[model samples]
Target: MRPVYAISGGVSKFAKSRPDKNYQALVKEAYDYAIKDLEISFPAFTEIVDGSVASYFSDHFSRQLMAAIMAQDYLGLCPKPSHRVEGGGATGGLCFQEAWKSIASGHMEVAAAYGFETMSHVETWKGNEFIALASDVSFDYPVGGFYSGYYAMMVTRHMKEYGTTVEDMAHVSVKNHINAFHNPYAQKRNRYTIQDVRDAPMVAWPLTRLDICVMSDGAAATILASEEGIEKLEKAGAKIPRPLVKVTGIGRGTDAMRMADRPHVDFETFIKDYATDQEKESQETMKYYQKLWDQGTRYPGVHSFRAGRTAGNMAYRHAGIHDPLDELDFVELHDAYTSSEIQTYEDLGLCRYGEGGPFAASGKAFLPGIDYGLKLPDKPVCPVNPSGGLIACGHPVGATGLMQAVFAIWQLQGSIEKHFNDDTLQVKDAQKGAIHSHAGTGTYVTVSILEKE
Candidate 1:
């Protein structure tokens, strides 16, 4: 397969209601921003670009189908090969990888990946109800399996199984929101105390409004190309960044939509299958795992995301990441909720299982040079959600993952100060990072490795 590089990326300002722009206009706004960053005219880009992949979570939000074609028309990539991609909240992540495939497979040398969502058309409650339909309607949905309740149940189980506390989860909220406070594109950029998070109105027990991501009307676009494609752009006066962000690896995972249908493996098999040689030999690690198993714990009961683990493992192996905590400089993951952020720390191998709670409070996932006002045990090791993640930036479904990709690219290029106009969220001397996207109650997940080249 050919190597793929992310040439540039852009995002529209994220907000609960972008009343001034329609979905297509939002996409155009992002696309124009990307081209402008590249120092290329949109018309010139139309002539050089090969095709595009449109990403959006649902047609229900727009009340329109084949939304991609409309966006295609708006972007003036008429008659170019194009298609649509969707997978719940992973829509943007999947779209990104799909564009990578297009370039790597020799199908298209230069591909445009864009995602958008106009979720403000419906009332917040109605929008949530529509989102709840992503669950198994035949089983999970009939029982009122909206995301808030489902995520709340999962986090409660996490608390029971791993001693994850509300305080621990609140730290994630505090950290991400503080990180977002510096991000100009983020929706909820206000700084908050841990108590502020806990004091917010409860959506579900122990889960507050401050803990969840808000729906937004926004869009994001990324320009991807092969080696030759990069040269083509350079010849066309595109001021591409040095040490381009390359797509080093990509992985996706899925599980049964119905949580009841999810299966679990026994402890011994689980360890043999999952534990590393070092972990298998560590007496302390073995004892800790054993204690959990002995306490009637199962591998990836609703408390954890098996799909996320699978995706992270695959991407890590593909990228040759042996220790994510030590190797990657940062991670912009789908933090739709604070609890999920902690859960993902374990899933992504930043820490051992059952230690996600402590990881949340450790400051290891925090960006350097930020004053979070919370006492932490460790300095920043691998800063997760440095872009404030979905919890801060707002989740526009399809736009969320692409937004992560854009931020990862920016961080790799050391352009956060230029883009965000605030150097606080920037990771200094960064080399490699990742973007993670998740959908529904762990039904679909995507992880991609991005590195400066």
Candidate 2:
């Protein structure tokens, strides 16, 4: 396989509504940003491109099909081979990896991956109803399994099993919103307090409005190129940024769409058969799993995401990451809600399975030097959601995951300040980072490792 590098990326402003432009123009806006960052003309940069991959969540939202074809024509990539990818919320992440695969498989030297979602076309409730269709129509959707209720149910189980408190979840909200305060592209940039979070209108018992990510209208694009492709672009007057972000590893996992259809393996079998080195490292960690078993806690009952764990495990192995909390500089995961961020910490091996709550409350996953106003016990270990994640940055489904890639590229390129016009959120001396995208009660999850090269 050939090596792949993400040379540049762009994002449109994330907001509840973008009536000024259609989806095609929104995509072009982001694509233009990426090309402009390379100090190259639009036609000049396109001259080196081999093909492209398009990403979007639902035709129901846009009320248009063949969207990718329209985008291809709009971007002037006519007749070049291109396809669209959709996997619930992981659409953009899947698109990114697909573009990488095109290069890695020697099919294309350079590929463009772009994703967008204009959810504001429908009423808020109508949009949610459309999103709920991602679940099993036979069981989950029929029973009114709205996404928030499903997440609320899962987090409640997490609270019951792992002693994860609403306060723990609130800490996550505060941290992410605070981080978004420094991000210019984020949709919700309010620096909220724990009280402010807790006081917000309740959606589901423990999850308030602040704890949930808002649906957004946005687009994101990234350029992936091989060594030859980079040289070709450079020859065409594209000033690619220094410290290129290389795609070292990529992994994905999927599970049953229906929650009840999921199988529950015993904890002992889980640890012995499938656990990774970091997951089963110490006797203390063994005891923790054992205690959960002793209390009749089974593996991956609605409380946890087995798919997320599998994705992280595969990506870490490919990236040669044995100790994620130590080796990686930061992580950008699908934080559809604050609780999921904590749950993902455990999934990604940043913390143990049950410690996700404490991990958030400890401030270990927080960005340091930025006063979150909440008195945190632990210093920063591995900052999660430094771009405010989906909760603060906004969840445009297709654009959400690619937004992560764009931010990761900028972070590794040390251009966060140049992009956001703010240096406060950049991880200091960042060398490697992970971007995780999750979909529908962990039905689909994608994890990729990006590093400076």
Query: Using TM-score as the measure, which candidate wins?
Result: 2
- How many clashes in candidate 1? 0
Candidate 1, pairs of clashing residues: none
Residue-wise C-alpha lDDT for candidate 2, range 1-453, written one tens digit per residue: 999999999999999999999999999999999999989888887777899999999999889998888999999999999999999999999999999999999999989999999999999999999999999888878878898999999999999999999999999999999999999899998988999999999999889999999999999999999999999999999898887889999989898998898878887788975576876788888888888889988878898888898998889898889999999999999999998988898888888888899889998989989999988999998899999999999998989889999999999999999999999999999999999999999999999999998
* Candidate 2 ranges with C-alpha deviation above 4 Å: none
TM-score of 2: 0.99
In order, what lDDT does every prediction score?
A: 0.91, 0.92
Which portions of model 1 show Cα errors greater than 4 Å?
275-284
lDDT of 1 at 440: 94
- What is the Å distance of residue 308 in model 2 from its true position? 0.5
lDDT of 1 by residue, 1-453 (tens): 999999899999999999999999999999999999999877778888999998999999999999989999999988999999999999999999999999999999899999999999999999999999999888888878899999999999999988899999999999999999999999988899999999999999889999999999999999999999988888988899998889999988898898877777788887876664446667998898888888898988888888998899889888888878899999999889999999998888888889999999998998878899999989889999998889889999989899999999999999999999988888999999999999999999999999998
CA shift of 443, model 1, Å: 0.7
Worst 10 contiguous positions by lDDT, candidate 2:
272-281
Cα RMSD (angstroms) for every candidate in the order listed? 1.2, 0.9
